[model samples]
Target chain A: MSERLNVSKTYKLYIGGAFPRSESGRSYTVNDAKGGFLANASRASRKDVRDAVVAARKAQPGWAARTPYNRGQILYRVAEMLQGRCGQFTDELRATGLSKSAATTEVEAAIDRWVWYAGWADKLAQVTGTANPVSGPFFNFSTPEPTGVVGIVAPDSPLLGLVSVLAPAIVTGNTTVLVASETAPLPAITLGEVLATSDLPGGVINILTGRRSELAPWLASHMDVNGLDLTGASGDLAVECEKAAAENLKRVLRPVEADQPTDWTAHPGITRMTTFLETKTVWHPVGV
Target chain B: MGDAVSVSTETLTGAAELRRFLHGLPGVDQVGAEERAARLATRSIKTSAKAYAIDLAISMVDLTTLEGADTPGKVRALCAKAAHPDPADASVPKVAAICVYSDLVAEAVRALEGTGVGVASVATAFPSGRAPLEAKLADTRRAVADGASEIDMVIDRGAFLSGDFQKVFEEIAAIKAECGEVHLKVILETGELVTYDNVRRASWLAMLAGADFIKTSTGKVSPAATLPVTLVMLEAVRDFRARTGRQVGVKPAGGIRTTKDAIKYLVLVNETAGPDWLSPEWFRLGASSVLNDLLMQRRKLTTGVYAGPDYFTLD
Candidate 1:
């Protein structure tokens, strides 16, 4: 019992702005990057996903209603807090087997990505699109807006990829249910801790850590899910996942080829936003 | 007259006068209240949010390498897939543009043309401006020539820090000249600047150097786009507008995720830049997923039903 207590690590789920152990009370050991047993993460249940959706739905409107500038500013604040934790993120990365410079770069990239998006919250509409020219007495213009609830598969490649997918989705306004990488899930879960402290509205981003292959298909086909990102799946699974996305046409970002080295400069903000955007053309009387 | 004693007293008085003159010099007064007031003025543009019509223009720079993507096609395909087919989504944001590395600018330009989408390229050795001046200029020129409508360039932080403000100013001014009709977004890369005072100084320097927009980061370093840094930059844009009567834009890129994050930026813009700068011309979001959730919520508000993922098609 003493040995168990000494080695046992407790992992909690972030839902509705609070950290709670899974209601199912199921626990699974997650190894560190070094193959050493690091912690026991909650095996989030289907009910937990539902609860998260409810919380996300509840928080959606006000969060969306906020001006983009304010959202940008808050995100900027999160970066400040995260910046203070550079040593922590770096230490975690090192534990994950990354070299010192690699860990530093990973942490820096994550923080930089946040700042990049922080500036975009209030400005995407003008640069990516414009008002439509309708041949009617009504005024019509299109503004790309947020999709309500998103189900994300945090990239299994660890820190950088995990944030790469997660940040783009939520930064633009959609709430997310993230299935973190099974093997390298610590950083993703740590992100949840960061979000919890950063004044983010609850349900905006809900993280679940377990077997990716187990939870992904359920999330992929789940009626509540609005988008899917498959950055970490195996080749065979990625194909099947695409077909699954067709179930509801969930916005699916297929995994990159294994042989290719990641370019680090793809337009993440645009690709992810388009997945959940719906074009709503408003019409109003012009002579009012 | 007591010649010797009076003469000594007179000399002392002259010396005191000389000390006061030296204290009144520009460098000496750099930290004075009047100087601080001027700096504050440069940082903030006072205004009422209601009067300002703030437009939210969001953009996405999908760093696939960070996501672990190796090829440009995969990156471009993803970007093409990311654009909304419908030009207008009442609920979601109409992504203002798609920003990519210059190497992929042509792809983004080709994918987005006639789709009502603009292509923005990160030039001047984006994410890092460690290149030579010639290389930076050539890079900017190439990106613009490749059909990039907006040029996001990073100012030389090293030179700026070394008090070579002239060098920093000259590089941006030169790049701005090369942009022709294209807009120039001068990135301060504020994380590397170290202090709000430096951030403020950099902001002023960029605007003075013909920057159409002053941005905060390269999205390449830690400690990117911070609220305090942004606040200081916003203050600079506001002051510049007042001093020059030429409105300069602010872009606080990097690490922003979620709707709450987007809104905070909006609030900052409204509070600092006033109502006029609220349009897309003045305000924009360099983001990836912000549009999707906006679309979903808008659907819910209008239809009174939660539209699942299938309601919208991916680009």
Candidate 2:
């Protein structure tokens, strides 16, 4: 019998729900934590960032228009799909240098975090919104609205950090263009597969794997992007992004405590979801 | 130009002669024309050439709004856009014209006065040329009197399809007469003509009957203005000029909604009809949404970042 060769998976960028190679046709070798070749992830260029923003901007209104309850159901469905793919995620995480137990634990926590955010999808508006008392004969009420397309810089904890940032953004109905962890992007690509199958709409979460420094500034400066999460960016890159983000007055969520490593395992409160939401206040005239 | 007029006077004598002349023209090889258009489309126009093409495409736009709901205010706004496509960027060139329904030509002319932007009105029961000849003639005359410097008249597709080439030819001639000094653009509504051969025939029929420009579609048809259809029309104009020493313009309206699509048409014009038609004077893009995109790309070229739709005004 002839020997069978191992069929390796190609790690391509996920834009608008389809896996496409970088428009610049550039790829960089990704090695496992032990310094062995793992895969060649697409080295996304600034053009990829532009394309991802376009897709995210296009999908945002429709996703935001989906009823809060429906969005909650869809998020829960993503958690369900992730639960079924736990083994694959664990294996990928283990390849990234985590122990077998650590990988399994991280995958479990990521799924739990997704569910935690999913529950908030329908309830966050109530908790954050307000009914104002005014002097006029008008019913004035304020509700939270998704802040259009958001650009997310995922932290180095590929699966858990990516899920922590992305789940909250979408649960609030905002679509996202995410730059995955540079060193460990294979897990992010795998998550894109889970997203594609999980009933989450296409373009709702476009994943780009590349140099964070190369891709982050374009996202921060893109006029159409309503919000930016600079979780993975640090040092000069973070400062440059923050400055560029001011060009469009984008709502920027700076990295915690100025690049202090975030403990992704900690209990994430509603701040992540609230950070990307804009409060819309509506007033109605009382009957004469 | 003199030779073309004489030829038209000779060939357009009757139905049989017009049919013989139109049918005698070369048949279009659909596969070849499509292949050539697709090949030209792949030409990567980048950097300085792209910047020039974008500006040239902008200048050639006939900023159009033909909805039944078009109001005078909307026509005024369109005229403003046609005059200054991007108020934020003074370097942007104004469009060639503002196209509207015949009734709103006055509004467009009022807003576009002194801007050097012509006001073009669609007339002759536009999109569907089913009206009587007198009504159609009246429509054209009304638009011309309303200060429309250009009249886009639709040919009676029903008459043309029924092999009454002479009737279609005479209708174009009559409308051209009503246009007087105003430039007359004959809309073939090529989508209804059914095939490439028919598109070729209609192109010749319109040009021979005294059309200043041969427009591809009314922007209301399903397959409005496609690359191959535009290609055949460009070839017709090129060959018509070669044979009669008269230059006719070509306008492809509808469904062209991107800087990329607009540039592809420019490339087609440059390659098929030669660079003589490259100017806004010889070729025009009849589109509304495509203008903003061209402006966006122009901004993208000038500034190194990709632009967003929110910055531009809605059409």
lDDT of 2 by residue, B1-315 (tens): 333334553546877877877776667899999999999999999999999999999999999999999999988888888888999999999999989999998888888889999999999998898899999989988899999999999999998999999889889999998998999999999999999999999999999899999999998998999999999999999988887789999999999999999999999999999999999889999999999999988998888777889999997
TM-score of chain B of 2: 0.97
lDDT of 2 at B273: 99
Which structure among the candidates has the greatest lDDT?
2
Q: Residue B193 deviation, candidate 2, in Å?
A: 1.2
Per-residue alpha-carbon lDDT of candidate 1 for residues A135-166, written as tens digits (9 for 90 to 100): 88888777777777777766666777776777
- Residues B1-315 of candidate 1 have per-residue lDDT tens digits of 123212221232342332332222222122342344334434422223311211243432222222224357765654554465233553333456667777777877777777666677788876768899899989988999999889889888888777667677778879999999999999898888876667777887787678898888877787777666776777778877765678888877776654445556666666667767666677666654544544544454454334454455442
A41: Cα error in model 2, Å: 1.1
What TM-score do all the candidates reach, one by one? 0.46, 0.98
The numbered model that scores best in TM-score is 2
RMSD of 2: 2.2
